[model samples]
Target: MRVVNIHERVYRAEPDALGALLGTLASRGDRLWPVGAWPKMAFDRPLQVGATGGHGPIGYRVEAYRPGRSVWFAFLRPAGFAGGHGLEIEALGEGRTLLRHRLEMTISGVARLSWPLAFRPLHDALVEDALTRAEIELDLPPTVRRWSPRVRVLRWIVSGGSARPQALAG
Candidate 1:
């Protein structure tokens, strides 16, 4: 099955400012990625083309990079994820910027089931949390999104039943 997932937000800030956040991805000073709740995005080397790392069980390598504009990761794991995902910064009119995250892939084998049943819900929630973090970092009021009950349960299951439901409500 082919899957295309995208999430974006327009912030009332300059493109340069949002692009700076993209530049800091996977670094200690990362202003994006909701690392604490979800797994931290780590790479063997610094952010650049060829760096390899991923959060949690998902894995990928930096397939392309443009310091302040965009980054794309070609999926490297989960057995059947074929294709890639990326984050981009788009400048709008004066003092406005759009941050977009997109995932395009084809899944086979178990992933055909997993993608729809479990991973998609969790992925959606995680991306929203990442966007909320970006808004908070930009000093903008967050557009908070409550997690779906299914997502809460999945997080708990993924955590081996140790994660509190309330805590998983990202």
Candidate 2:
């Protein structure tokens, strides 16, 4: 088991505002098809996340959900291959929300060991790049203040504390 990729970003907006933006992006199931899911109706179902693209026949389980605050999802790959992805929204100030996305991927079996070492870095880089692109595409404002490396590390330490499944209100 090994980490393949990890990417995160901080948006300079309140959690509600950020959620609104994410809601817009996730509004159309077709729009999210590239990531996963088949039709628009799929996203309508409560907490149902299934694979639709090249990621294989994987599905996501909502691990945690805090309305207008944070959300966590676990990707369940076939044959015991599992990974977790989560978004943490922390209120930094009056009008700023620190959005942190964390990803943990573990590859098992003899055939998968090589993949983690060979593709981990690439996946990490790709995730970071994708987040940057998403920020640009979403037209989010620049972060008012960026957290220090130490602070970020500390935050990561406590990230696991918040993990509970809940229905998302559309």
Candidate 3:
């Protein structure tokens, strides 16, 4: 299966300001990733090219980085996943900036089943939550996206039927 997924949000902030948030991605003071809700993103080294890590069951290595502009990661786990994903800050002129998350990959073997049935739904929810975090941190009026029923159920299963997972709580 080939998948190309993209999620983005426009903020009334300059590229430099948005880049500052992007720079905090996996750090202790991460103002973008929904760390408490989802598995935290960590790397053997600081955020830079070649830094390796990924949240939860996903594993990846940073393939490229542009301090305040973008970060691209190449997949290294889940068996048949081939390709990469990245986050980018695009300037939209007039003090507006677009924060975009894009995933492009081809899944073979078990991934063909897993990507559509499990990973894709969870990934969508996580990305939306991350974008919401950015909006809250930037003091922008947030446009929150609710988890779909499928996402809620998956989170329940993944969390072992406990109370709503932090990722699904807010």
Q: What are the models' TM-scores?
A: 0.95, 0.53, 0.95
lDDT of 2 at 78: 46
> Per-residue CA lDDT of candidate 2, range 1-170, in tens?
56644455766556676664444333342221113211121333443244222232435666666655555667654444567766566677877666666777666774285345433433343344334433544465422223334433433343454422211111
Give me the overall lDDT of model 3: 0.89
Give the winner by lDDT: 2 or 3. Answer: 3
Indicate the TM-score of model 1.
0.95
> On residues 1-170, what C-alpha lDDT tens digit does candidate 1 reach at each position?
88999999999999888888888899999889887778899999999999999999999999999999999999999899999999999999889999999999999999999999998999998898888888888888888788889988898888998765432223
Q: Say which prediction, candidate 1 or candidate 2, comes out ahead on lDDT.
A: 1
Which residue runs of candidate 2 sit more than 4 Å off their true CA positions? 2-5, 29-58, 78-80, 114-122, 137-170
The positional error of residue 170 in candidate 3, measured at the CA in angstroms, is 6.4
Among all windows of 10 consecutive residues in model 3, the one with the lowest summed lDDT is 161-170
lDDT of 2 at 27: 39
Global fold similarity of model 3 (TM-score): 0.95
Model 3 alpha-carbon drift over 4 Å, by segment: 163-170
